[model samples]
Target: MRPQALLPWCLSLALAVPLVGLTPASARAATDYQAEDAVISQGTVATNHTGYTGTGFVDYTNVKGSYVEFSVSASAAGTSALTLRFANGTSTDRPMDLSVNGTVVASAVSFPATADWNTWATRTVDVPLTAGTNKIRATATTADGGPNLDRVSVAAAADTQAPTRPGQPSCSDIGEDGLTLAWGAATDNVGVTAYDLYEHGNKIAEAPGNATGKALTGLAPNTTYDLTVIARDAAGNTSPASLVVDCTTKPSSDTTPPTRPGTLAVSGVTANSADLSWGASTDDRAVTAYDIRSGTTVYQTVTSGTSATLTGLACDSPYTLNVVARDAAGNTSDQSNSVAFTTKACTTDGGVPSSIATLSTGWTIPWGTYWMPDGKTALVTERDDFRVWKVTKDGTRTQVGTVPNAVTTNGEGGLLGVAVDPKWDTNHHVYFMHTAAEGNRVVRMTYDGTTLSDYTVLLKGIKKNRYHNGGRLAFGPDGCLYVSTGEAQTPDLAQDKNSLNGKILRMTTDGKPAPGNPFGNYVYSYGHRNPQGLAFDRNGRLWEAEFGNSSKDELNLIKPGADYGWPTCEGSCNVAGMTNPKATWNVSEASPSGIAIVRNVVYMASLRGERLWRIPINGDNESVGTPTAYYVGTYGRLRTVTKVPGADQLWLSTTNCDNNGGAADGSDKLFRVTID
Candidate 1:
C-alpha cells in the first residue's frame, strides 16, 4: 500500500487500538522497533531534537543512499501495516525508498514537514512479508537525506540466533605498526554482519560480513600481540571468539635519515614553468620521498624520482630553492645547497594599463563589490564597519543598510562578500558572508531598492579567526551560490573534507547543499588555506585567488570536488590526486584578495603586492598566460576588483584603512580602470 501521512488520525488510532493487534487473528501482536536499535548506515543516533520515541532517532547524514534497516520477523506470510514515525523540519520534502526484503515496495515516498523537528508524525504503508526474517529498509533518495526516524511499529519477531565462531586467524605482511589478519568466515541463521578483531580483550578492528581479512594498524613497534576474531550478526548477536593468533611487530631499528640530495640544478626555465633534476639521496633502508623547498618552507614533495617540474610560476621572478631528503622512518636530512634562477620575462597581451580614474572616495575598507542585475547599481560591503552601500555606475553612493550580528575579527574578518541573487529583481534577496560572535555566517537580506530588511541566516558554523577568515561569495552561472572559506588559521582543517572551513561551498538559495555535489555536501572543493577571490570567466569556468602561507600565492581554475593540496603543497606540486594552480606568485608579490574577469582576462587585486595582476585566459580555458602587473605601488593595498556588467572596465577598491594599510578611517577609495 502507498504511504499516507498520519497526524490527528494517527493519535486517535493509537489510543483506540491499544488492544486491537494483541491476537494472531489481528495480524499478530504489534511491536515497536526503535530505529536506534536497527542497523544504520551513513546516519547517527541523535538526541539533539526532542519528542522522539525510545532513546533517540536516526539522524541521516546529508547524502543520498543513506539508510536504516530493521530486521523483523512474521508468524506467517501475510500483509502487514508498517507505521513509521518521523520528523522533518525543513520546508522541502525529504523522500526515501521503502523496501521489504530487498525489494522496493514504494519509491520516493514523501515525508513532508511536521511544522518543526520537535513535532512528530507518522506514515503508514502495507507490504507483504515472508514468514521468516524480513528486512525493512528506508533509503534516502535526495541529497538532503531522510528525516529524523523514530521507530517502526509492526507485528514481527526479533532475530536472536548468533553466528558460529570464526575460524583460526593467521597473520601476514607484518610490519612495525601494522599487519594483515585473515580468518575463515562464520555462518549465522540471519547472516553475519561483521567480524571484529580483538587484541587483549579490546576490539581493535572490524571487517565487513563478507570479508575474512582486515589490515590492523597503530600497533606498538617490536610488540607481541594476542589477537582473535569474533563474528556478529545484524541482531547484535556475537559469536564465540576464534582461535587466537600471536604475532610480533617488526623492530624500529632504522633511525638514520636519508643523505641530502646532491647537485640540484634548474634547467629549461620558462616564464611560467621550470624543470629541475637532482642526484638521488641514499638511505639506510629506503628513501621514501624528496622535498623541494623555496627558502625554508617545502613547496612540493617528490615521491618516486629525483627529477621534477614546477609550473604556475610568476613571470620575470627570481627564485632561490633547495632540496631535502626523507626516509621512510619520517626522518629528514638537512637542506642541500641552494639554486637560484630567474624566470624569462612575460610577453604582454592586451593587459597593459590605460587609465585609472577615481570613481568614489571616503570609503573604509570596501571588501566586496557585486553588480546588480540591472547593471546600473552595485552592492558594496565594508569590511570593518559592517556597512553595505548602493553605488551607481556614475560613482554616486548611498548608505543602504548594515548587516546585523556582524562581529569583527579585528583583522581580516567583519562584513565580507556580497552577492546579489540572479533573480534579485523578483526576490529582492541579497547574500553576505560575515564574522559573527560564534563563527562566520552567510545570511540573506531583502532590499527593495531603498533599504535592506528581513535579515535571515542561511548558513553558519564556519570557524573564524583573526586571519585566514576567507569570506568571498559569488553566484555561479548555474544559479547556485558559491562561497569561499578560510581554514580559520588552522592549517590542517584545509585538508579535512568534513570541515566547512577551507572549502569552496556550493549551495542553493535556501542554503541547502547543491544538487550533484561530489561529496553529497555543501563542499565543492577542499584543501584551501585562505581563498578570497572567486570569479567566473566567459566560458562560465570558475577562477580563484588564494593567499599562500609564506612562499607563494596561487591562482587556480576550480573544479568540483578537486583537492587543492593545502598544508602539503604551496604552489605547483607533483603529488597525485592534488590539483596544481594555473599561476603562482611569490607571497610578497601577491597576497591576492578579490578577482574579476573582463574580456577573457582575469584581474586579480593584491593587498601586499599593491598591484593589479592581469592574466589572459588561454584559449583552452585550462591555463593562464603570462601575468603583467599594473598600478604597482600606486594604490595602497588593493582589496576588491569587480567587472562592470556590460562594459570593458573594472571597479577596484582600495583597503588602505585596514590593519595592513594602517591608513586613517575613510582613507580607502574606489576607482574605475578601463581595459585597453
Candidate 2:
C-alpha cells in the first residue's frame, strides 16, 4: 500500500470533515502533504526530527537516483507555488531537480545546509501545473542524494501586472554605418526577461531584460532614425514604449576622396617613436580620417588632422610611413608620399640602482625641484606651503623666501613649477608657476643665492581647478620658459586651441609668447590632460609625463602645435587627429609626475606608484629603451626628480604629506640618487 494508506484513521477523519459552517474541501485553500505521507520511493522515515508538523519526515538514501514523489491536486491549469521543506546536515549542499507531472519545472534546486540536523528551511519555486491530480517529484542530482525531506505544499499563483515603462532612450556613438541606443532599466512585479527594440512601428532587435543598450549596424549614411524600447516580463507582459530618440548618421554623398596628403615630414625621432606631419588633404565631402600606414599596416588613424606621433617603434629601426585620406563615404584616396626615418640607438646599459641615499627630511609636499647655476645648490617648491628652499648636496636646506601673492585653495594648486634662468649668473631671474586669487600664473623673481625678491607676474590666464593644475616649469632648449597646464577637469577645454589650459605654453622671460610659437600664441602643444613632467633630451627633444584618468599614464614627446589627444584618446587609441603616447603605463604603476634626463636616460618620478622609472635614451635622443623600476614601495611617494647640474646624481623629492599618501605631516624627505 502507498504511504498515504498508512496514515492514522483519526488524522484522516479530521482532514475529511470540515469545521462547522466552513467551506468544503474543493473550495478551500491549497493543502500541504508531509513527505512520509506521500509514496516514499527510496527513503526511510525519521521520527527523531523536530519542528515538523507531521508524524515523521523522510531521510532519503545517500545514493544516486534517490527521490520522493507527491500526488497533488490543482483546481485549474495555471501557475502554482511549490514549497519544499528539507534539512541538510552535511556540510555540502544537496541539489535536486523538480518535475511536475512528467515535465521538468526547475533544475538543480539547492537544499543548503541549516544550523543542525533539527533545523529546517523552505525553498519555494513557481511552477506550471495542469488541472486534476498530478505528480510532483524531487530527484537528487548528485550521488550524495537529496536533503532530509520534510513536506511539500502547492498554491495557485496568478500574475497580471506588467513591467514599468522603460526610461527615455538616448543615442550615441553615431557613425556613418552604425549607432548605439541606450535606456534606463524597467521594473516588473515578476522578474523581467527581455526587451524589444523598435524602429518606427516594427521590432528591429531584442535584448535581455538586464541589458540597457543595443548597437544597430548596417545603417545607411546621412539617414535619420527614430528608435524606442520596450521591456518584457517572464509572464509575456510588456511595458509601454520608451521615449523616442532621433539619431542621424554621418552623411555620405560625395564619393570623391580627399586629395593625397603631400609633403610628408618626420621629426622628433626617438628610440621608440617619431613625429610625422603632412599637408592637409581635400575631399568632395570632407576628409574624416587620415590613416598613417607603415608598409601595409595602418599605424594610426587621425581625424581631420594632418599630423600624428608614431609611437611604440623599435629602437635603431627604420620605418616608412604613408598617409591615406578617407571621406564620410569611406572612399580612400591615393597614398601620400612616404617618409623614411630611423629611431635612435640605446645609450644606457638598461640597469637601475637598487639603493638611494637620503639628502634631507621633513619637507612638505615638494612639487618641483631645479638645480641652481652653482651646480651644488638646488631649489625646491612646495605645493601646499607656497615656499621655496635652497638645498645643498650635503642635505643642508635654507628657506629662501615665500612666493609673493601665492594662494592655495585646492590640493593641487599653489606654488609649483620652479625654473632657474639659463643665464642665472647674469640675470638672477627665477621663474615660477603659482596659483593666485584669480588663477594660476607664471612669475619671475630675482634670487641672489640667499634671498628672493623682485617678484614680477608675466603670464596669468591659464585656468585652475581644485586639482589638475599642471604646474611644471622648465626652460626649453630655446632658452624660453615652458609651462604645462591642466584642463581643470573640463573635457572640452582640452580640444580648444584658444584655451590656455590643457596645453604646454612657451613664453619669453617677460611672459610674452615665444617668438617661434606655432599658433602665434603662447600655446606650444594642446590636448594635454594633466601633464606635470618636462625634460629635454640631448637632441633638444622635449619629453612630457602626464597623469591619465583610470586608463593609462602617458609619456609624450612634445611638438610644436601638436595635439596629444586628451579627451579623445587616453592612451594608444586608433582615433584620428590626435597624437598617441610614446609609452603608456597602467595608472597604478605610473602616476608619473616629474621627469629628468640624466646621462641620456629619462628618469620619471611616480607619486602613487611610489617608484622611480629609468628609461634609456637611444642615440640622437631618437627613441627610448624599456623602462626599469626602482625604489618601489620602499619610499612613500615620489614627487619630483631633477638631474643635478654638473654631477652624476639626481635630486628626488617625496610627497607623503598630501591627502593620498597618508604619511604624517613633516615626514616627507629628499633623496640624492645615483644611477649606475
Candidate 3:
C-alpha cells in the first residue's frame, strides 16, 4: 500500500493534536491564514489531523461540494503561488478544485492520502490575483470529500502602481507631410511598458516607454492638431495624461522656382572688389536670397536684393559674373545674363596696414560713424550726448543736430547706431537706433547736407537695460536694414522668438519684417546674449560679435532661423540643437563691439581688451582663420570700426569718456587705418 494511504482509524485518533491558532515561523513573509480561521461550510476544525501548520486543519464532511474559503490579500495584481497543506486518513485519493476570487483555477485536483492521517503533503498552484483583498477556496469534487485543509498563503508578484504622468509634448521638424513629437520620460513603481499618443481624443500612435520622441507621417499640409501622451506599466495600469500641445504643419512644398534673374551688370569695380546689380526676379513663393556666381561657383549669396559686392579679387583681373535667385523652399532660378568686368589697378601696397593715423580727436563717446555719399564727410552719433555730428576728413566736427525724443538713463543707453540709406543722394535719409522714454527705437531722419530734420520712427519696442542694450545697425547687401539687439539682462529673452530684444532683425527701410523672414517676424536670427557687431563678408554672409558674461566672448556666423544658445551655453559646447560660435575669446582679452569686413577679412574693435582683431575669411566665407590682435592696451576702448567707402581704409572710434575706459576729457578720438 502507498505510504500516503490510510493506516487505521485507531492511528488517526492517536495522532490527533489539540486545536490552536499558531502560525509557523517559516511562513512569516507570506500571509498564512489558518484554514479554521476561514469561512467554512459543511466543514469543521478537527484535531484528527497531524503535521499541519497554523492551528488545527479544517476537515470537510464526507459529502461532495464541501468547501473552506479563505480571504487573501495581494499587494499587487499579478500571478501568486498558492500552497495547500492537507492529509487524508482514507486509502482513497480525494479530489478538489481551487477557486480564486470568483473564477476556478484548477478543477479536480488530486489530494492523495499520505501514509494515514498523521502524514501531510502540500499541493501548489499559481493563480492570478487582483490587488487588495481576494477570496480563495478549496472545494471537494468527489463523494468522499476533500482531505484535511490547512492555511492559504498568498504573496505579491510585483508592484502595481501606475507610472507618473509624462511631461508636456513638443513638436519639431514640422514638414508639410510629417512631424516629430517629443516629451520627457515617465517614472513608474515597477517599470514603464509603453507610451500611447492621443490626438483629438483618439489614440493615434504608440512608442516604447523608454523612447521620448516619435515621428509621425501622412499628415495634411497647413493643418493644426492637438496632441497628448500617456504612459503605461506592465500591469496595464496607465498614468495620467500629459499636457496637451498644439502643432501646425508647414505649408505645401514650393517646387516652382523663381523667374530667371535678368539684366546683370557690374559697376564700381575696385582693385579687390566689384559692385554688381541685377533686375529683380519674379517668384510664386517669393524670392528669399540671390546667389551671384562666377562660372559654376557661387561668389556671394545675398538676401533677396538686386545688388551685392564681390570682394577679394585680383587687381585688374577680368571676371564673368551671373545672378541666380532662390526662394525659401530651396528652389533656384536660372542664371541671369552674364556681365564681365576687370577690377581697378591696386592703389595701395598689397599688404595689411601696420600703423594707424589719428583722423580726429577729442570726442566724448563716439558710438557710430558712417561715410557720406561724397565719401569725404562722415556722420557720427555720440552715445551719451544724443548728438549727430558731421566730421570732415581733416578733423572738422560740426554738430548737425540732436535727435528729438532721444533720452539717456544708464551710461549705456543713448544715441547708438547710424546707417546711411543706399539711395542717400535721392532720399537723403539716415537711420538711427537710440533710447527714448518709451524704449529703444529705430528712426529715420532727413540729412540735407548742413542739418538733420524730418524724423520718422521706423521700429520700436526693443527692451533696454543698464547694460546689454545692443544697438548696432547696418544695411545688408540685400538693401534691407539689419539690426542687432541684446537680451537686456533677461536671460530667457534670448530664446524667445517673439521678443524684439536679443535678436538680429532683418527689415525693410520702413521697419516691416523683410519678406521671407524665417518666422514671419522682424527676427532673422535669435538667441543672442548681447550682440553688438554685425558685418557681412565678401560673400554676403553675416557675422556677429557678442560680449560674454565673465566667461568667454563669441564671434558667430549668422544663419536665418538658427538658435545660438544663451544662458545654456557660453562658448563652444557640444550641445544639441544650438549653433556654436565660429570663434571664442576670453572676456578680459576681447569685449568686441563693432565689426567690419573688407577684402575677405573681418576687423573687430574691442572695448575691454582695448585692441582690434583681424580674422581672415576662408573658403565660401563659411569659416575664419586664427584671429590676430592689434594695438592691445594702446588705444583705450575702441568702439566702432567702419569701412571707408571706395578705399582700403577703415575709420575707428574711441570711447574713453565712458565708465569703463575712465580717461580724462578730450581723450577719445577717431583714427583711420588702411588695410590691404
Number of the top-ranking candidate, with TM-score as the measure: 1
Q: Candidate 3, residues 1-676: lDDT per residue as tens digits?
A: 2123222221122123221111111122566788989999888998765677766889899899999998988777777778788888789999988998878999999998888887878887888888888898899998898898877776554343568879989999999878999999999876788987866433568899889999988776677877878787765555656777889989767779899988998888876678888899999869988988776555557885688877545455568889899876667899999998876764443345446999998888999887787898889999888889998877799999998898874446899999888778987989999988867899999999899999899888787655677899988767778899987655556887767878998777765677656867788898898899989776667999998876789999999998899868888888888999998887756888999877777888998877788776775647786665666566779999998878888889999898667787678999999875
Q: Which segments of model 1 are wrong by more than 4 Å?
A: 1-351
> What C-alpha lDDT, on a 0 to 100 scale, does residue 219 get in candidate 3?
71
Note the Cα lDDT for every prediction shown: 0.84, 0.80, 0.80
Evaluate residue 464 in candidate 1 and report its C-alpha lDDT on the 0 to 100 scale. 71
Superior by lDDT: candidate 1 or candidate 3? 1
Q: For candidate 1, lDDT tens digit of each residue in 360-463? A: 99999999999999999999999889999999998999999999999986567899999998788788999999999978999999999989999999788787
RMSD of each: 19.0, 29.1, 30.9
- Can you give the TM-score per candidate against the true fold? 0.52, 0.50, 0.49
Backbone clash pairs in model 2 (N, Cα, C under 3 Å; residues 3+ apart or in different chains), count: 14
What TM-score does prediction 2 earn? 0.50
Q: Over the full model, what C-alpha lDDT does candidate 3 score relative to the true structure?
A: 0.80
lDDT of 2 by residue, 100-219 (tens): 887888999999998888899999998888889989999998889899989998887644456877898998899888888899999986667887786543356789988998999877
